[model samples]
Target chain A: MALKPLGDRIVIKQVEKEETTKSGIVLPGTAQEKPQIAEVIAVGPGGIVDGKEVKMEVKPGDRVIYSKYAGTEVKYDGEEYIIIKQSDVLAVIE
Target chain B: MALKPLGDRIVIKQVEKEETTKSGIVLPGTAQEKPQIAEVIAVGPGGIVDGKEVKMEVKPGDRVIYSKYAGTEVKYDGEEYIIIKQSDVLAVIE
Candidate 1:
C-alpha cells in the first residue's frame, strides 16, 4: 500500500546515517545522535485551516530536516515510512 | 528579550496542563502526559530553501500541536518559551 499524508501532513523517509565521517574514522553509534534528515515522498495539498490558507512548501524529492521524535512511523510495502504534518518539517536540504 | 524564530522556525509557549479532568477531580501530574499543545508567539520569515518558498502557516495567538521532544526551551522576560522550526508544529487549533 502507498502512503499519503492528509491535511497539512507530509510523508518522509529517514535518511541513513553513515557510520564514519569524511576522515574515514569510525564512530560509535552511541556517540552519535540519531539524524533527523529525511526525503519527501508525498505532500498533502494545502487547504483552508482555521479560516486561513495553508500552503505546502516542500515537494517530492526534497530532502528535509525535522524533529527527532516527530511523526508516526509505519511500515508499508515492506518499507518503513513516517507521516508528519508539513509544520513538522524544519528545513529543506539542498 | 523578544524571541523570534529564524528561517522556518517559530516560537511557542507550551500550554499548562490541568491537574484535573473535565469531571473536576484532581489527578497527579505524573498521571498526565505532557501537553503537546502550544501558543504561537513569533514566526520566522520564510525565504528560499532548496529552491522552494516556505510559508508561515500559524500566526501569533494561534494554538498549535507539536512533537513533545521538539524545540529548545529558554527563559526570556521572566517567561519560558520554546523555539522550534515551523515543521515542528503539527497542527493549528481552530
Candidate 2:
C-alpha cells in the first residue's frame, strides 16, 4: 500500500462478512450490514495531540473492530481501503 | 448525562445541519447528506491499549467533526444523541 496514515490514522482493508457458512446458502448483500472488521495495512506515528502524548498501540497486521461507518473510504489501485483514526478502533482482535 | 463511555467511547449530540440559511428557504432532509458535526457531551477514560498508553484529549462541550454515519443513535427524553468512539471524531472545531 502506498498510503501511510498520519497522526493516529491507519489504513484498513475491510473483511467481507461471511454469508455462506452452510453449503448452498447465499444470504444476499442487502441482508448484511456494513462490515466493521478490518485488517490494518499501515499505521501512523502517534505524537502530541491537543498537548497530550499519544502512543500507537496497534500496528500493521492487526485485526480491529472499528466504529460502524467510521472512516473515509478510498479506492486505490482498484481496491477499496478505509482510513480511520486510531481512536475509531474499538478493539484489537488477537 | 447519565451515560459514561468506557475506554475511548464518547457520547455526542449531533448538530443540526443548517439548511435554512436563506430566509424562508427549506431544504428537505432527504436532500441533505448525513450530518457529521456534533457536540461532545461525555468522554471516556483512556488507558493502556495494546500495551500503549493512551490519553484523552477532547472533553465535554467540544464541538467535533465525526465520521459520517459513525455513531449509534439513541433517543434520550425525546432528544437524540449518538455514541461513538473517539477515533470516529475527525477533528475538533475551535
Per-model TM-score, in order, reads 0.46, 0.45
lDDT of each: 0.64, 0.66
Q: Can you give the lDDT of residue A8 in candidate 2?
A: 74
TM-score of chain B of 1: 0.75
lDDT of 1 by residue, A1-94 (tens): 2444545787788766562243243323232333367788888777743335689999989978776443565444456666677777778767
**On residues B26-53, what C-alpha lDDT tens digit does candidate 1 reach at each position?**
2111112233556788888867544556
Native contacts recovered by candidate 1, as a share?
0.00
Each candidate's fnat, listed in order, reads 0.00, 0.00
DockQ-based CAPRI category assigned to the predicted complex of candidate 2: incorrect
B73 Cα displacement, candidate 2 (Å): 12
Off by over 4 Å in 1: A1-44, A47-94, B19-35
Model number with the top TM-score: 1
- Candidate 2: segments with Cα more than 4 A from true spot: A19-35, B1-94
User: DockQ of each model against the real complex?
Assistant: 0.03, 0.03
